[model samples]
Target: MTDARHIEAQIYERLNKVIDPELGRSITDLGMIAAINAVGATSQGDGDVPSYDVTVHVELTVEGCPLSQTITNQINGAIVSYPDAKLTPHIEVSSMSHDKLADLVAGLKAERKQNPFNKPGVKTRIFAIASGKGGVGKSSVSANLAATFAALGYDTAAIDADIYGFSLPKLFGVHTQPTNLNGMLMPVTAWGVKLISIGMFAGADRAILWRGPRLQRSLEQFLSDVWWGDPDVLLLDLAPGTGDMAISVAQALPNAELVVVTTPQPSASDVAVRSGLVALQVPMKVRGVVENMSWYEHKGERLEIFGAGGGRRVSDQLTETLGYDVPLLAQLPLDPDLREVGESGRPAVLNEDGALRSDVLGRTFRELAEGLLRSE
Candidate 1:
């Protein structure tokens, strides 16, 4: 019986590493492990290696939780890692009772409160991607940058702040709705990044994305209602235009810095400066400018598809106007794969296996991400 008790203790220790994907807390700590029963040696035990049959009872936050399989697989992996003992594992998972779930949520809210990022001492780096107009690839830039951060092992979360033109759900390939426990909602995890978008909720593209009757209120909902456990970075894909969303974000997230996206053209660069100029009206910072579709390589020669100096022009203007050095952070080439692969729900800078690519686009994005994290 001492041996059984010892095995159970070890199992509990290992389970501390198994985090609930949505809640971002260990299942064991959430009081999910109701019991652990370990019996004597099983036939599968290697000769004298003291093998035992262990059953772990798991209580999930909700019934038919979409990520139950992922949680189960991780628990199984944790159990089988006990090489000292030949442990045959069985995990019995069931939904927590209504009262228990309510208590757990209440406790979590009381501890962390709502809108966790705005609190003092929070280290989350928030970036709001903006543009003067549509078709400049702001959402694409937001999706790729967020993916690059996640692939590099930074805990990352993104909100599709573009209420009318939400595309992050498609770009990140997220098809699952956030699991709602009582009133609190969990952001969906896809491509190693935590994402929240109305596109994933109502099931239709344009119709569902329009739920944000008030853009500012919707931003608040995404901030307060979702359970984001203090990620290292938070990115907002702002709508393409100089409008209320930027001010709303500045008011809600005082630390949010703006990263303006512009194409290589006088028309785009001219208005791009206005988007960055929103900082003049609000207390947010204008981080830098990203020039998209700067050039296209055609038959061994570089072709200036949209014209060459728009990114620099916006950067120079913003720097002079904002009285801070708003440098041109990156110059992205026009790659067809950025659209095709993105339409397939994967960021172009990442490989099929979800690893950061070693190609030019990937390297450039990595540099951009590193630049953003660097000190001024």
Candidate 2:
């Protein structure tokens, strides 16, 4: 006969494997496994097996978590692994109180501070996508690149670090604010990518005319206040131009690699080169260049709408100026359908054969994601 205590221990061990999908921590460690009561059969009936009724109380961060079903299933599956247990586990799901959740968030923040990735020990591949000017598709590229990486099964997030010009929420079609659980802010998920942006907090068209100090404070809060769960890749959509916000981003993520975006025109490249130089002020590496609107495909011929070689020119200048090889990561052509998809609040990568179909640019984004992962 199996000892009841032994079975209980085994059950606890199994529960450790059941992690909170969002938090990336086991329910046992997170204090989400509120209670585990095992009621054993007092006596065995003739030709009948004994049974144990186990009740597991789970505390969810949000009142209406989309992952509640998944958590329940995981808990039930884990409880049944004990031999001769005759498993009948009753799972109770409840939300943590605001105060208690606040404490949890505090603890998580402390843990992140101590985490190697957050520290200088572990390397987190941070990419800042900056352009010389707005409407150059920097935000769109950041959003799509993040989605592509997440689709490839990497833990990824795109921070709308452009505090004043936040647009990630619209691009990813996420309208909800991050839920606070035990003080930790759970990032909104869409297209398998976790996202945090000021757009979620402020209205899309609402103007935020904050000063430099307030902007810096907001940026710090975005990084420290939110629970990012130690992502494998973090893509930052930096506001265009070299300003205080860009400087703050560089300071916040010291190891961030830069990918300057520009059109094919020489003037665009010239302006983009200045932004790349600003990245150098923080001494961040200029990874490569992404040239948007390089050309438009008319029939089978590629028409150079924005002129050409701007991406190459920027890459060449960065390599020469920085004393390192800065290659052109990709040249994204002008796809009207891609712009339409963005306007419709859906990423082109997820739609099959859509405007942003699986073409060279798409492949390049995937490759860029893979390369970053490998570098990390």
Candidate 3:
């Protein structure tokens, strides 16, 4: 016969294993376990072999939370781990309303203000991938860089801030929208990277024609609404040029490092330098320049079809204007295989080894990722 103390200890041990899947924290720590009662068996059961009814009261963070069912299952499973336990475990799930959620947000804001970046002691590195023009492979680079970071075992999230031009979804092949839990949006994982994009909310045929203020509001919603859960790195894929979205991102993530992308042509570099200048206007620091479509290999020769010296010119201009050293991070050559893989909804960084179309581009991405880590 199990003693009362033994049963209580068993209950505590089991409950310790019950983790809130969304928050990735034990229920006990989150204050979700309101009560734990071990009811004695009735007269219908034998007294020698006691039947225990464990009741756990759970408090959810948000009303209409989709993860409530999952939490209930976990709680029930935790209570049934005892071998001699015969009674069914009762689980109750309740939620806090909108007012409580607002209070929670206010508390978080206070905490953030106390320790910006919420690192408390550690630093949170933010990277912003920007370009002067669209279709310049900026999204692809952002996705692959994020994938590489995750592959190297870093907690990373890639945010598609390009509300109108969201291509990260198709590149990563993430089809499902994030599940909402306790008023928090959980990011979907792909290629080991957590991702959120406006594409998940807006359909393909629907046009995103919002002006500046509306765009800023949406961006803020994306940042605060989603539960990023303290990632080590947050990569932002900004829309091309110095638009409203870009300004909003600069203002919101003031500590973000700038990585400008451009082609090898002088005209492309000229525009790229202008974009870097715009970032400077926000008083944001420019990290370096990345030259995409630097060249293409045909047969045995390197063909500079887009013209050369664009990356160098942009880097030089940034260094001169910022009065700081701005190096050329990487020169990503043209790779048809990369384009095909991206079109097929598979980023080259996650593809099988040696299966990548352009080994040069792959190496460049890996090197860039290494540089990021080294800088940190």
Q: Count the backbone clashes (under 3 Å) in each candidate.
A: 0, 5, 0
- Residue by residue across 147-171, what tens digits does model 3's lDDT show? 7788777888888998888888888
What's the true lDDT of residue 15 in model 1? 94
**How well does candidate 3 score on lDDT at residue 357?**
29
Q: Where does model 3 exceed 4 Å of error? A: 1-21, 31-122, 202-204, 298-301, 352-359
Looking at candidate 2, what is the lDDT of residue 230? 71
Tens-digit lDDT string for candidate 2 (219-243): 7777776777778788889999998
- Candidate ranking under lDDT, highest first, comes to 1, 2, 3
Which candidate tops TM-score? 1
Stretches > 4 Å off in candidate 2? 3-6, 40-52, 80-85, 97-103, 114-118, 202-205, 352-358, 374-376
Model 1: per-residue Cα lDDT over 260-317, one tens digit each: 9999999999989899999998889999999999988888788997888999999999
Position 216, candidate 2: lDDT: 82
Looking at model 3, residue 62 earns an lDDT score of: 66
Best by lDDT: 1
* Lowest lDDT block of 10, candidate 2: 114-123
**What's each prediction's TM-score?**
0.94, 0.89, 0.76
Q: Listing every candidate in turn, what is its Cα RMSD in Å to the true structure after a full C-alpha superposition? A: 2.4, 3.1, 5.2
- On lDDT, who's better, 2 or 3? 2
Candidate 2: the clashing residue pairs are 101-182, 101-183, 105-182, 105-183, 105-184
